[model samples]
Target: MGMEQQAVEIVETNKPVILQGGCLCGAVRYQLSAKPFDADYCHCKQCQKSSGAVFQVWMDFKREQVTWLKGEVSEFESSDNVRRGFCKQCGCTLSYRDTRYPDYFTLTIGSLDEPSLIKPNYHIYTSNQVKWLSITDDCERYQQERTS
Candidate 1:
């Protein structure tokens, strides 16, 4: 059978439907059972530093939806309110979690196996975006964290 057909069959079966991914060194693997929400580009300084980029694309999912399939991640309290998880072996940032929002996790889109399938719907903390870095997309832009 075709790959697409096999995927459909896997979904139709009672078997787990998971989106798999790992760190640069393949030491930390993960699985997501459900699609993420609130995909966006974050220009916050913390995101920029963690990703070593002008901005970071992140997607949110319920904490329960994620399952660690391989090596465990090393977590650091990036700030008083946020904790970031990454692969200690390769320093590949994987996720962000807020102390206030324990039920949700923010996963780095770049870490996904098929990142192109999930597009950022908006830009957040745009006020902190680098002056030289400009957004051309018509997607909604928020000067700070999105209220909605």
Candidate 2:
């Protein structure tokens, strides 16, 4: 089953879901009150550089749904209006935020305490994907950002 289905099953359980996670050094911790949405594998150049990976899995949540339980993430503007968050202690990429979407916050799936609980539903920015890497998933592929 997909991550979306898994998340739905979790929510349907009627239990209070408090998803928790942190940075590599355990210095930056967070909790999510609600399940995340728009989970995808991003192949944008910025994502690749920031994550030091061919692609990065990210999921979006309403800003209010997330609470910092421990140290806060240090952010750097990756582009004109886009900011990326990371732990200062261990430099683990944590989040991505765009000024255009002030109400939404995006988190790296690798930062989650249970990364297996979520999965990428699609692939974005395929135009920038590495030539050596091959994506064999059946998920939708977008050359750029997925237009709703």
Best by TM-score: 2
- lDDT string, candidate 1, 1-148, tens digits: 0111101111143554457787999999988887775678899999999899999988777789889899998999989988999999999999888888778887888898767656777888999999998689978888998775
TM-score of each: 0.85, 0.88
Clashing pairs in 2: none
Deviation of model 1 at 96, angstroms: 0.1
- Which lDDT values do the candidates have, in the order given? 0.80, 0.85
What would the C-alpha RMSD of candidate 1 be, to one decimal place?
A: 8.2
Give candidate 2's total backbone clashes: 0
Pairs in steric clash, model 1? none
Off by over 4 Å in 1: 1-18
lDDT of 2 by residue, 76-129 (tens): 998998999999999999999999879889999889987877767788899999
TM-score: model 1 vs. ground truth: 0.85
